[model samples]
Target: MIKVEEAIAIIEANSTKMPVELISVHKALGYVLAEKVFSPINMPPFRQSAMDGYAFIHSIKHQYDVVGISQAGDHSNIKLKPNEAIRIFTGAFVPDAADTVVMQEHVMANKDSILIATMPPKLSNVRPKGEQIGKDEVVFEAGTLITPAAIGFLASLGITEIEVYKKPKVAVLVTGNELVKPGKNLKKGKIFESNSVMLEAALQTIGIKKTKVYRVKDNLKATKQALKSILKKFDIVLISGGISVGDYDFVKEALLQNNVKELFYKINQKPGKPMFFGSKNETLVFALPGNPASSLTNFYIYVSPAVKNKMGFSEIHKPKVVRKLNAAITNNTGKTLFLKARYDETNVTVLNGQSSAMLNTFAIANSLLIVPQDVEEYKKNQLVTLLPID
Candidate 1:
């Protein structure tokens, strides 16, 4: 067995990054950039009016002759002379000679001229060219996550395709003959298998769309055959159950029969002590414990980071913060325990139903309270480390 930190370090050292590919910017959400992206042209492209009013050269004169109107998308050569102004709407290109724009509410209309009720400062309502982004400027650097705002900014520059790291292809294998699909009649000795569906949803939330699922009986031959097929097809393989040293647990033997080199067998942690990690060539494998809560916990703490790293992300783990505990609790386990918790800005409530098999508490938890391996008891309002779950 190894400490949890050592296990994470091993995974960090062994994780592989995916190859970069050009994809449509519209479909690049949540992907990390492979190269720096620069703007081809100025964001505004021209000095534009910021308000619906008059465009004029800044001067002390309160009145001027109305020359012509300039609306958006009009390229008419409308230039302003001294004591002359043009009726311009918002977003209309300001004349080259115009230095200021006054709002319509501040100007009084006359027969052939307009009276300035109040004059604003020079360039008060003008949007300068390239105010947002200049031509050939670096807008986003490599490894930046593409977001909705990024899409809009890229579209403004007419960028249709962008280079980004591809999402990993994943495969999930559930090993247990006693497990049956949900919505089916429960037999006397069988329970509904839920780890596959749960893991699938979890992966989808992280932007991994290519996933394949396989079910194997508790026999070594069946497990070995499924592992072989999945290993060839996916970059990441997640096996739930049959990792412990029970009589029926054949996952360890099955992995060894294949080419998977075991990195670690167990970790010094509660709920998921029998977790396993290995790799065959470039593919990463995580064989989590059989319990529902335990498997899910391990996925968040371990597998998610490896996946994020493979997808070229700099930050792979969940965000951690220190918060005060809302209540006191006693932990007799001699291992590091992650308790399901709900937290606000300053405090966290350690929820009930923390058993390895229970998912009820996990459903309501937004955070995990980390209790160190050596500590046994905690008092109310004591500060503890918390890991926020996405």
Candidate 2:
């Protein structure tokens, strides 16, 4: 048994970063940037109006005649003189010699001449060339995760394509002969299969779009065959349920028999101590506990970050917040525990009845309370670390 941090270090050290690929900006969302993104052209490109108003020289204070109207995407260039103003709409290019924009509401206009109600500041309400972003400037550095805001920023800089790390292919396997699919009538001593679906959704949320699921029975031969067949197809494999010491638990033995070198097994943590990690060829395999909450917790704490690291992200841990516990928690003398809890702006309350098999308690939990292995009990108002699900 190893400490949590040591196990995490092992996982991190074993992960190989994926190679970079050039992808269209439209398809680059959630992928880590492989190269610095520089602006090809200035944002706004030219001096433009920030509002619908009159563009004129502020030196000509009182009144002006509308020389022409400029709408967005206007190609005809117009020069302005003193006491001359152009009726410009938002995003229209500012004409030459026009250094100020007086909003339409501030100007009293007739057919051609306009009266300025108040004095406008020089360069007011005008978006200057390269004001937001300059040409050839680095907009994003390598290792940035391309998000919606990043896409918009790149588009603003006239960048339509970017280089990013490719998403890794993951294979998920759920093992158990007594498990039945949802929507089927439950036979005696049978339960619905859920780990694959839940893990798939969780992976999708973390930006892994390509995933394959395999269901293997309790038999050793079936498990070995399934693992062998899928090992060559995916960059990583996740096996749920057969790593424990039960009579039907053959996942560990099968991996060893098939040349999968074990990295570590039996992390010193509750709910997921039976977790196993290994590598067969170049494919990484993680065997999580069969229990729903335990499996999900392990996925968030370990597997998700590993995948993100492979995808080239430097920061992988989910954001955490410090909160005061509303209820006292008791734990065994050893084995670090992650307890499901609901936390809001004020307090974090541990949900009642946190068995490994229960998913309902996990459903309402926004965060997990981290209890060190050696701690015996926690009192109310104790400040503990909360790992958020997001």
Candidate 3:
């Protein structure tokens, strides 16, 4: 057994970053960049019109002879003498001979010429080349999370591929024979199994969609076989239940038989004190308690961060905030308590039902208030650490 901080430090030390691969930028959304990317070409490679109007040389006379027209994607370089205007639309390339554009709404058109109705200066409504980003400039740094806008930006630059960190392969194992699948008829001493689907959804929320779930009986042979097989294939393995010491508990013994190195067996904390963490080569394993609240709590506190860290994210932990308590509380259990709570901008209210077996309070709670092992009492309005789970 060890402290919570000690367990977290061990996990971080053992976390391995996934390898980088060059993939199509079209498929790179929700992935992290492994290398710094530079802009391949200047944005708006030519002088672009910023409005639907007329392009012309600025004249104090406020009138000009209408020349040939130019719309978007028209590349003909129409020569313009002094005071000659070209009918132009938004996003069209501005002719080099013209230096300014006037919005069509402000100008009156005659048969073959137009009178500028608005007093505008030179170079108005014209987007100069390279105004957004210059060629060979730093566009994104390593570890940037790719988003939809990023893909469009790269595509506009004519870049088809990008270097990004590969996503992790995960496997979830649920162990227990007494568990029953949901929607089945209720039987004697049987509970509906939910941790498998619950964990799968949680994994999806963190951008990890490649995962497999397995259910194992409470026997040593099946436990050993499952552990031995998944440890060879997956980057991260999460097991729910069958970790505590009981007559049928075989996970600890089976893990030893499979030669998985034990990094930490337990943590001196509330709800999830029986949680287990281990590793085999590059494969990391986490065995959480059977209770719903405890399992999800451990997942958010430990597994999620470790998985995101392996995906090349620097900030992996859940967001922590400090707020004053809405109600007074006292704790003298001499163990760290992860209490479910709801917090507004300035104050947090601790919810009822802190049992590890029930998730009634956790469902309505948006944050977890960590009561340090050393701190005993918190008067109303005193500051405390609040970790938002949503």
Highest TM-score among the candidates is held by which one? Answer: 2
- Which stretches in model 2 have alpha-carbon errors above 4 Å? none
Give Cα-based local distance difference scores for all models: 0.91, 0.89, 0.90
Pairs that collide, model 3: none
User: Where does model 1 exceed 4 Å of error?
Assistant: 110-112
Quote the positional error of residue 34 for candidate 3 in Å. Answer: 0.9
User: Pairs clashing in candidate 1?
Assistant: none
lDDT tens readout by residue for model 3, 24-119: 999998888899999989998999999999999887878889978889999858999897899999999999988999999999998699988895
Give the best candidate by lDDT: 1
- Order by lDDT, highest first: 1, 3, 2
Model 1 / residue 166 / CA error / Å = 1.3
Poorly placed runs, candidate 3 (over 4 Å): none
How many Å off is the CA of 263 in candidate 1?
0.6
Cα lDDT of model 3 overall? 0.90
Provide the lowest-lDDT 10-residue window in model 2: 75-84
Error of 3 at 336 (Å): 1.7
Could you give me the TM-score of model 1 versus the true structure?
0.95
TM values, all candidates: 0.95, 0.97, 0.95
